[model samples]
Target: MRSIIAFFLFIFLIHSVQAAPLLQATISRESQVIGNDGVTHTSVFQERMYRDQNNVWLERVLPKHHQHSTDAKNKTSHKHLDLSETAQHYFLDNKKSTRLNLVLPEDKTVIHLQTVDIEMLGLTNCWTCVFSIFDSQSVKKMKITQQGNGYTWYESQNAKNKIKIKWAKLQPDQNPHPTSEYYATMDSIWKIHLERICRLWGLNLVKE
Candidate 1:
């Protein structure tokens, strides 16, 4: 009787370990057109968060360039992106959203609240891969294309300031599927931008 009880207990523990619940989440994205002239602009904001799970959020925002200018005295030039003096309001959900502004001026009119179909990246809830039973190979191999608006926002010295947004609809290295190719290709592109942005904003993404 004792031996049987111990055996059952061990089996129950094993089952419990293999049957953990998956994390639930909600992801959203948005875009905006700014500046009075509207000739130069930026858009594209994305957010990912867990709804049923603990509070976790990741966000990325991009603002457009308004106008480019140069300083006469120093012969140095700077691009003056346009903005009102209001914080731009972007609704991520029915009750949740965020307010964002350009980084340079730090004080300007924010793009107002508007209904825009900003392409947001939705997280794949694949926590089950922790269990040996769940097939995680597909998640690793399968690729999805996230199509949406893209833009560049920056401030630079007049002579060297050249901003261009180059995004790949597909990647360089060929994949069995076109979709999968961009998956591997996008990392390098994103890394370059992230590094540049961090340097320009005086922010250290990786801790020393």
Candidate 2:
């Protein structure tokens, strides 16, 4: 009876971890930002962190059809975040709060954009997951582009200049795929890096 109980407990724990939503960072503070041009702008940003095991599998949120279908077979389905509505859906379902809303920042001054790349976890089909954060908002918009070394986030217009604040890549490449382990590693690294960024910006990660 004791062994049976222990085995059931272990299985239950594993399932709980696997069932959780993908982990991510949350934007938590806002302030008035004035650029060098003397234009007053709104600085929007949230604290960022990686979600634990349950959250790491959030990639599955993408339609199963897109995941299973070939590029040509589901050309239309692959069009996920390209549309604003789709992006909005993702943002809402993530459950993390933002520091600001639809209000556009006041000043339009161009701010220098910097990027950090980290390896992604749980993606057997792709090589890299580019996690990008904007200076204007805390929500980190992620684009899972093709996997390869030639990939450059700084050059992509979709990753626009000015508003971009930071970047982190999570790499996971293995044949036959080690999805869970890679996802956990990526989450751990992202959480640590995000905490460091918050400290540098004088933001309180968990407090708000």
| lDDT (Cα, 0-100) at 154 in candidate 1 | 22
lDDT of 2 by residue, 61-177 (tens): 233343322365544232322211111111111344221111101111111111111112111211122223222122224333333443323212232222222234444521111
How does candidate 2 score on lDDT? 0.24
**Runs with alpha carbons beyond 4 Å of true place in candidate 1:** 1-94, 97-107, 116-208
RMSD, candidate 1, Å: 21.3
lDDT of 1 by residue, 64-171 (tens): 663335466755354542333111212123233322212222322222222231112122223232111123344343333333543212221234222222232323
Q: Please name the candidate that would achieve the greatest TM-score relative to the true structure.
A: 2
Per-model RMSD to reference = 21.3, 21.2
Predict model 1's lDDT versus the native: 0.24
TM-scores for every predicted model: 0.19, 0.22
